[model samples]
Target: MKEHPEGGTAAALLADPRIRRRLPTAGTALGAGLAVWLLGGWRLGLTVAVLVVIGDVVRRSRKTSSVTAWQKSSAAERRTEKQLKSLQRNGYVVLHARAVPRDDDGVSDGRIDHLVIGPSGVYAIDSEKWDKRLPVRTMSHLKLFHGPFNKKDRLDEARWEAQQASSILAARCGFEVPVQPSVAIYGPSIPWKVMRVRDVDVYAGNRARAYLRRRPKILTEGDVERIFEAAQQALPPKYPD
Candidate 1:
């Protein structure tokens, strides 16, 4: 197995606030301009440019809030990485914002913030960086605080992504591949909770990696490799060609 880099580097890159904000916005603007020029006229291109600038400005204003969220998600991922490293010190993979299998919506919906598929089993982790205590319940649907408002839908989306991916794998491989969805909160403000729903485990910032490591084995070495290859092919590039 190839050796993997330290979790700190991946975490730092993941935590880097600019990639998510600046690079994508720039790329989108460029793409829009190119499309407008090729198919439409200068007027359409100019309009796109104007919208791009406006979008950038709006994003700049929201950078602080976005950065805060990024930090939390990265923390949980790094925690999960620590355990994955133990299982296979090297060759353990961590893919961030990987789109769900077979996405045609055009929008990158239901991203697996941190996906670790190793000798143990496949883990679909959702990182939540929010303030306030989350109440633990046996039921999956529950409201959690979100600043001035309460947002329960934040982490549910991740779980749904995991489910969809699991179904895709099962159909492709002719076996029920278990995709364990876990919620890892990364913030001092949010209180801890331990809950289970439809086999998905809900946990807080603390012990997230440990929790993932404890999951039952669903794929062997070969099976893991096959799934990883499939996911790699399905993953969208961070940068454009």
Candidate 2:
């Protein structure tokens, strides 16, 4: 099977030394405890078995939480990547998991989930896996509600990432590069396929390709190549060696 980019949440988790080291200990404990229960008497055997089971349960619980988080993040990214690949087939230049440096110390910051340049425009896309059970509700003043919780700030973060991309491209190209901010929401029960909030375009993961495809053409092929090259130079490498 093809591997996801190294920067992906799931990939990073699986590659973590700590997680890798701890996961095997649980299985070893279970096996050892089972062997001791068979060889030793009921009293000592039961106590050892119970203690090992409890320790294993706690360890597994922590690992399960990390795995669940990675699954959600990886699923969202994978969904967005599939849609972006469709855009590429239609002549879009797409970049996945582009990490940019923070302004404070030039250290690597979070990645832009996807970056696309094509006839429509340049887009800095972020993918999110929100709760599937809760219905997304758009409120007044560009706010978004899910059940009783407010989640308007996610849009703000997407817009900021777009701005960061725009700034990087503009600096590279010596002119303004209008990068649209977009959020591809996965695992959310969205009423509509697409929703626009001020400057950010929000859409369900499956509909993101169509949403971009339907946009008005703003860049030519030459512009797309130039912008893609500039992005490649400005953004950090997508994967480590």
Q: Candidates' TM-scores?
A: 0.53, 0.65
Report the poorest 10 consecutive residues by lDDT, candidate 1: 64-73
Maximum-lDDT candidate: 2
Question: On a 0 to 100 scale, what is the lDDT of residue 135 in model 2?
Answer: 85
Q: Per-residue lDDT of 1-241 in model 2, one digit per residue for the tens?
A: 8866765987788789977866676577667767787888666766775687688766544333112333333767766666676677677988877766544433224567788899888888888888888888786538777777877667767777788889989999888898888888877677877677767787787777888877788888888898999998898654533
> Candidate 1 residues 124-209, lDDT tens each?
87766654454433333454444545444554565677887778767776677777777776654433456664455666666665
**lDDT scores in order:** 0.62, 0.74
Full-model lDDT, candidate 1: 0.62
User: Which segments of candidate 2 are over 4 A away from where they belong?
Assistant: 1-73, 101-109
Candidate No. with top TM-score: 2
